[model samples]
Target: MKIGLYFGTFNPIHIGHLIIANHMVEYSDLDQIWMVVTPHNPLKKKDTLLDDYQRLYLVNLATEEYPKIKPSDVEFKLPQPNYTVNTLAYLQDKFRQHDFSLIMGEDNLKSLHKWKNYEVILQNHDIYIYPRVSPEIENLELKNHSKIHIIDAPIVEISSTFIRENIKSKKNIQPLLPCKVWEYIDHNNFYRK
Candidate 1:
């Protein structure tokens, strides 16, 4: 099976996330995409973050309707301050029958070298980059981008941190998250400052 691994903290999954995953299946050769909910991202601050399981559950609830998209706790069981290289390594070992690809944003392209074992990850896996609004990849970058496929995904500015902070401030976040995720956040009284 060819799988696109779109890893994120999720915090709470939203429509923008779903759209990208759906687009991956519709436009790409990948059979399925596993929304690998990272328990901890090495680059992100965790002070405002919710419990990993709650975030994972929200991911599950938000993505339940899409057969090709799945919510995963794969990173939950992995080591702390999760890095892509490690997750990929673990997944490769566990699901030997499957081939994996990396799914990420265009901005991430500039920082790929900063990631752990980035060279190995780049060489071993196919990368699918969904473009953001800022810039287009130039030809020189294209040579480097050859190992990565760029797709123009819908650019919604919604962010999990923004949503979390909005909830804490008791601001309306109805437009940021899926209805089910919003309900879950409200029910759990999450982010109440």
Candidate 2:
């Protein structure tokens, strides 16, 4: 099986995330798209970030109906301050029969070169890039790399930060989130500080 790892904090999973994950699984060769809920680094202050399990639950709620997309808490099990390259290595070791790749936005592609062991990641796995409205230019070296594939997915501008801010302001951000996710957040009064 070909699995695409889509990493994010997903403090609260939203429609934009679902759209991209769905589009990748449907449009690309990936058999599954794992929405890897990134764990918060212990070194950083946990100001606006929700509890790890809460974020994972939100991801689960958001992706439960999608057959091809599922939520993963792999990073939660790994050592803190984990890097993508390490996760890829671990996943590859654990799931030897399956092929793994990355799913990221074009904006992330711009800063790919700065990531730890980025060259190793490029050599070992393919990267699927979704469009994002960003003013920064992508790295010239990676722009034409054979391991990187540009996917013509829809440009979703909605963000978890935006949704959280709206909820805090007592605005109806229902349209931005999945039904179950919205219910969970509303019931729990998340981000309403």
Candidate 3:
């Protein structure tokens, strides 16, 4: 089976995430999209990030309805400062029967040259890039690479940062979150300052 690994912190999974996962499964060659919930991103600040387990739980709640798109806590058991290269290598070793690909945005592709062993990643696996609002990644050098596939997926403008800000101000974030996830966040008072 072909699997696409969509790695993210998932501080709170939102509609945009769901839309992309659904699109990857339905429109792309990916048989499944595993939402790899990273516990700690090497490049991001952790102050605003929810606890790893909580973020993983929210991801699970948000993706529960989609069988093809599920939450993966694989990083939680791995080392800190989770890097995509390490996770990909570990997963490849463990799930040899499945073909794994990386799912990311054009923005990430623009900065991928800075990632650990990026050249190795490009040579070994295909990347499914989705459109982002940013214009900077439009001129990426790797755009023409045979391993790069631009997916015409639905683009949702929502971001986890926006949802967290709204929650902090006691605003209704229901529109951006799945119903069960919204309820869980509401009941647990997550992302409150």
Candidate 4:
């Protein structure tokens, strides 16, 4: 089976995320799009992120309706400062028969060179990149071996940081996240400073 691993710190999974996951399964050959909820990403600022379990729960709520979608907590038990290459390697070993590929935004594609084991990741798996409008993906110095596919998805500018700040300000974040997730966040007073 072709699995697309969409990794993110789903501080709270929002509609924009749902749209992309749906698009990947609806349009691509991918049999499933696993929302690999990362506990800690080595490249990001730690302070701004929500607790790993909370984020995973929100993603689970958001993706529950789609059988093709699964909210994965695979990275939580793994070592902190999680690197993509390591996570990919681990998942590959665990699910030996399944074909795993990376799902990311065009913005990440721009900084592909900086990721741990960039060349190896390129050589081993396919990357399904969705557009991140602000950062237009102009041609980077192309590596000869990588397999990259660009996907045109509805460009939603909603960022987790912005949602967190909005919740902190007691602003209505209902439109940003799914109803179930919003309810959970409100009940738990998540992201409130």
Q: TM-score winner among the candidates?
A: 2
lDDT of 2 by residue, 1-193 (tens): 9999999999888899999999999999999999999999989998889999999999988888998999999999999789999999999999999999999998889889999999999999999999988755453568699999999899999998888899999999998898999988899988999
How many collisions between residues are there in candidate 3?
A: 0
- After superposition, candidate 3 runs with Cα above 4 Å error: 41-45
Comparing 2 with 3 on TM-score, the higher-scoring candidate is: 2
Using lDDT, rank the candidates from best to worst. Answer: 2, 3, 4, 1
lDDT for 136 (candidate 2): 56
For all candidates, the clash counts are 0, 0, 0, 0
Estimate, for each residue in 43-69, the C-alpha lDDT of model 1 and write its tens digit.
677787778888889988888888998
**Model 4, 16-135: lDDT tens per residue?**
889999998889889999999877665677786777787888888898889999989988888887888999899899999999999988788888999999888998899998888764
Return whichever of 2 and 4 wins on TM-score: 2
TM-score of each: 0.90, 0.97, 0.94, 0.91
Q: Quote the positional error of residue 150 for candidate 2 in Å.
A: 0.4
Ten-residue region with minimum lDDT total, candidate 1: 135-144
- Compared with the true structure, all predictions reach lDDT values of 0.83, 0.92, 0.89, 0.85
TM-score of 1: 0.90
Candidate 2 weakest lDDT stretch, 10 residues: 134-143
How far is 104's C-alpha from truth in model 2 (Å)?
0.6
**Which pairs of residues have clashing backbones in candidate 3?**
none
Candidate 2: list runs displaced more than 4 Å: 135-139
